[model samples]
Target: MKRSFVALMAFTLLIAIIGFSAHLVVLEINDTHGHAWPYGNYGGFAAIATIVNQVRSEAQANGWDFLFLHAGDVNTGVPESDMLYARPDILALDMMGLNAMTIGNHEFDHPWSVLSRQMAWADFPFLSANIVYKGTDKTVGQPYLIENFPDLKVAILGLTTKTTEYIGNPEYVKGYDFLSPDEVAQKYVPMLQKMVGPDGIVIALTHLGIFGYSEQTVAGTPGAVETAEKLDPPNNPYGGSVSLAQSVSGIAAIFDGHSHTAVTSPFNVNGTLIVQAGSYSKYIARLDLIVENGHVATYTYKLITVSKDIKPNEAIQDLLTAYQIVGSGKLNEPIGYSKVNFANEKDSTRKADTLIGHLITDAVAWKFKDMGVQAVLMNGGGIRAPIPAGTITYKTVLTVLPFGNTVVILKIKGSDLLKAIQWGGVYHPEDTGARLNEWGLTYTVTPNGVENILLDGKPIDPDAIYTVATNDYMANGGDNYSMLKNAQQYNTGYVLADVVKEYIEHISPIESYPFTPRWTEVK
Candidate 1:
């Protein structure tokens, strides 16, 4: 009897030890934006695959439960990937063994047909709990995925930013509704929790962004802080990942994207962990968690730069090379040359009027000059890359403007035009993508609003009817340019990239344009 009792005790203790302790390693990347190839030693899918394989192998060797997730925005940015409709990226991500990815606004850059085709090509599920067919409960993709391990179960719920309704191409996203993230999580978290059972972890894989770390309210959008704190209605209009963490009881962590923010360390908000790996495939975020009694007891987080130092994975590298060869055949044709570089970095163009901004707006205005288009307006977000000094090619122009937006002429009242300009200039001009670039008009941004608005060197008459050239995206009210939504619009049926290329070609050996600032700011 004594021997039997001792043996029983030993068995019970071993069971407890095995059940109560476990190791989990999660690798995440967000907003990759079609960087399947390396940019001068910075980032590429091949390098990312090598890192993922290495870490996955390490995890297996260490007996840790492993997961690889993408927070979203895997499309757009690179002409090589864009030309192929991001098929190369989808294939490479599948080869890398991606467990899951959320839907990003850029996923809708192309029409639904393209997105559906990409979805069919991908092995892993594209998750989004908040996107649904209009007036229906049917979700566009899997709402959440449950992964079971030896001693732990993890439920990942995907949430996309609500801004997709206005930020995405309207025609492409017409039939889909971007439901409130918090509301969707509220409905899903409890169900997920019940499924995972006690001690299991629930995480939000989100595309919602952090607009500003210091201010909860930036450009009238609720950021992570505001969302977490549950600010008033006007302030907390759009709930983000932080909001999901705070409002939902069971979520343990959130991996987020869409503001291109690189969170160096995990943000602990309301006992939930939030992290973003930034954009452009530049970094991979790794989180190591220790699970005790089915709950996360401790963790360590870091952002690893995907630099050229790492050897590329052979298979992924070969796949990307094949796609590059195909893409290069059409994109490499030289169109013109620039005497000086035109800067269009996100930070530069989005804050102040830039040379590239001028060039693009000028191109649009020039295209419709015969139609009596007096001025041009463009959203800085539409401009993606800088035009380097030498050897401009079709690839170069396409890289700068990949959305394929068409030039639109709107007969808008001058009052409404001023409103649009003010909305762009005064509303968090520093980071908002809606910041405006102009041609044939000049304005000064003031603390109150815009002042000294001029068209053709004369003050804009409020009641005068004016023809303004802008992309179809904005004319269709993209980027929250509501003032232009009701205006009379005529689509020129010309792709903006082609128009810019033609303009550059026409003005080849492009050395200097009017350098006078089209817009200025007052302290």
Candidate 2:
């Protein structure tokens, strides 16, 4: 009887220790794309900070520890952040106590020299195991970091998308090689596990776009499912070509960005959990992980929208207000004024027609008309927002074209242009570029219908090689238009934002027109 009682007592002790184990609370926000302020009632860093603080306090009260992380892409959106070279956003994040972050493609939007300087201001460690230094195999940041808890050690690692080679400025990424995520995991996981002594938990922060696949080609056209797939580690001894949650072993939770889609519930893939907060500070994702007796027992995730109703923390609001006040003073200076009004109206949450798309594409085409350019195909996916009605400023120009893309003229056969257009259209039909910027190009976009693209009332001859003016993004085959890379590029030496700014200033106030379907419906 005493033997049985002692055994039962031991079991009870185990349960009590497990219940008292320290729990972890992970908060994630990604794809700010430089949206540091509230745009159209949706996002702002101050509001996000408020929500995070509230949740952190509540979670702490519940015996949980908090770690704030940003998946990547902290640069290039609103005028305030981009105008100062994303300084305000980085400073703001530092004030909020960002724990760790993954290096996103946009981080190299500026010159590498500039990025190197900016890294000094970051409060958290920039993590990317796949990005190797130029001419060396060294990783960009420390591969992994282990945080000690009362009952467990948590190791965090980072991975950047291989697509960064094509998306980022090749000049900045020179001499550097971005290894495959799957390969990196296979090598590093074992090393980290050994170092953690087999009792630690692993987490991966990834910026490899989202899971949803868009089947379209570049040049704003549509066709078969002939497009580049989203980056995922391949199926192997490490894992499958699925989400980071599925591929990397030992990753208990994943924070993802790049595609900008938010997954609130834990996307279960082979028993791993994935969570992503929507982009631009619109949502803060919280993951409550319960570790019992040296193992993860449960993971609860929630997506908290930073709506206006939530009272902004006073301290955060004051900091934001001070920054904006200074930013407004500098940004409000009139470089040029608009004589018309432009608006990007939407039905529900899907993209629709926009006058800004038309004007910007027109400006780009016009800038290179003297160079024998036949047509220009500007990807609608690149257009971030519409120029607001009323006065336009230098800041407005930056917001409209935040990516710092340069203009390049590509020499391509007319046939390839048509093929490219068809691909982009079929995949992202709602996009303005796929819809042919309706205002400038003459084309008919119908599902499975004869793909026809006309320039200046004439069908392009298939055999003719034409000079095409486009941003460097398309020149590098971004948005699944790989064929353009072979096309000889003639640099126009024109800053994309400058050209658009000149056009907007000359066009005066943007005139709002009735919203109409940009693509024709054919039977």
Candidate 3:
């Protein structure tokens, strides 16, 4: 009689579930970079909201649970958003009613005061488990948020990329150390297990990326070493979002960001779904899950392109339009024109010099020549975008040099400079951050070290002190350039973007600038 009763109860539950079909839907967007308007063919926050609302409306009509999530980097790109301290993005996200978000590296682009104020305005929780108060175990931001759907509860863990310590503006991220994602995952998953139990879904909403690191040895390449040591950082700590997910148990999926990838489908690893949406709000990631008995039974995914065809939310569109009118007065002012197009792709800058590299480095050296600056060095990773042929505006210059680092004049011996360059270039081509873009000196960079460094058609004097003009980022030992950490430095009090814009305006119709042949293979 007991067995019969148990079967009857099971049948009744199944019948109930079948009668009321239910689903869990997760909508994700990542690395938005403040493209809140239709950028050429890519994005507009109004359209994004429209699509999101439509999807939600349909889901609700069908009795499905819905969650709208943003991965990170919703700021620091478009002039309309960035110039106003990224408030447009915050306002738009609030209007859209974002459920949760992971704090991205760009969140630290502004000063702490500004960042704090911005965070205060956000409607949803900004999450990062690994980012802690300096020398303390407290998170710099909220660690995670929980969403309870009918019959199932999900705990979403948030982790920022560990690279923010050195890669972001140095002063902004000072005194804080980003803990390893693996350690963070190991620390939190156990507690989460107690809270959510075995049947609940645990999702990691992380900004740590799948940065295409490979462990397999490729001849004469540093990528593998970086991958191995990076995968398991110092103290044998785990690194990257994937490593964190693979190390921890019970995580059902990881909605990842920071690489600016457009993953059309989930990258499944060890039964966990790792997914990323394209950067700049180009697409919205839709993850559909079928829950059975308080557990995810199966899932499918799609990336909805924020194409021009979609209608935008009228309110958001009006707000963006107003902001654009207010911000565009000077930003849209034509600075100059360049007839020649120059590639600034990271690989191009790291492997060999491009015209854009030459233009920036030359501008730095030329702008500060009166101070006896011998050469100027900027990181290849610093060159954010290519200088397109034809019209160039103030906004264009800002996008290229967005960090707002000041020109730092430093006195350094050639030997120490070489060490700094070599240290920074330890993983050239494979690592763009280490590739030094410079003017007033031409050097052939190899995997082994820097050689053939020329100054005035002569070899660099190792003992002689030379005046170097570089952004404060490197002068402050950013990107692991330890040798540059203690150099005799002077703050020029000039923002890098202003200097670049000035140069462009001064040299109005720039017809051509060729490669000075930096980063030779030296075979």
| Clash totals, every prediction | 1, 25, 0
lDDT of 2 by residue, 20-74 (tens): 4557889999888777777677648878888778777887787667789999989
Indicate which candidate wins on lDDT: 1
Would you list the clashing residue pairs of candidate 1?
199-294
Candidate rank order under TM-score: 1, 3, 2
Which of 2 and 3 is the better model by lDDT? 3
Model 3 residue 349 CA deviation in Å: 3.0
How would you encode candidate 1's per-residue C-alpha lDDT over 228-251 as one tens digit per residue? 354312224375666666666777
Off by over 4 Å in 1: 1-19, 213-235, 429-431
lDDT of 3 by residue, 1-523 (tens): 9999999999999877664334789999988887888888855899999999998999889878888898888768776788888787888888988999998988988787887888898988999899998999989889988887775677889988887887777778886888887778888877886787655667888887664632111221244324433444332242566576557766778888887666665665556677777788888889998765445679988888899778889988888888888889899889999998877664466545667878888888889989999878888777777778999999988888777789999999888887876665445423456677777776666656776768766777789898999988888777766687667999999998899999998887988775556556555
Query: After superposing candidate 3, which stretches have Cα over 4 Å from the reference?
Result: 1-22, 213-238, 345-347, 425-430
**Over all chains combined, what TM-score does candidate 1 have?**
0.93
- Report model 3's TM-score to 2 decimal places: 0.90
Q: Which ten residues in a row have the lowest lDDT in candidate 2?
A: 216-225
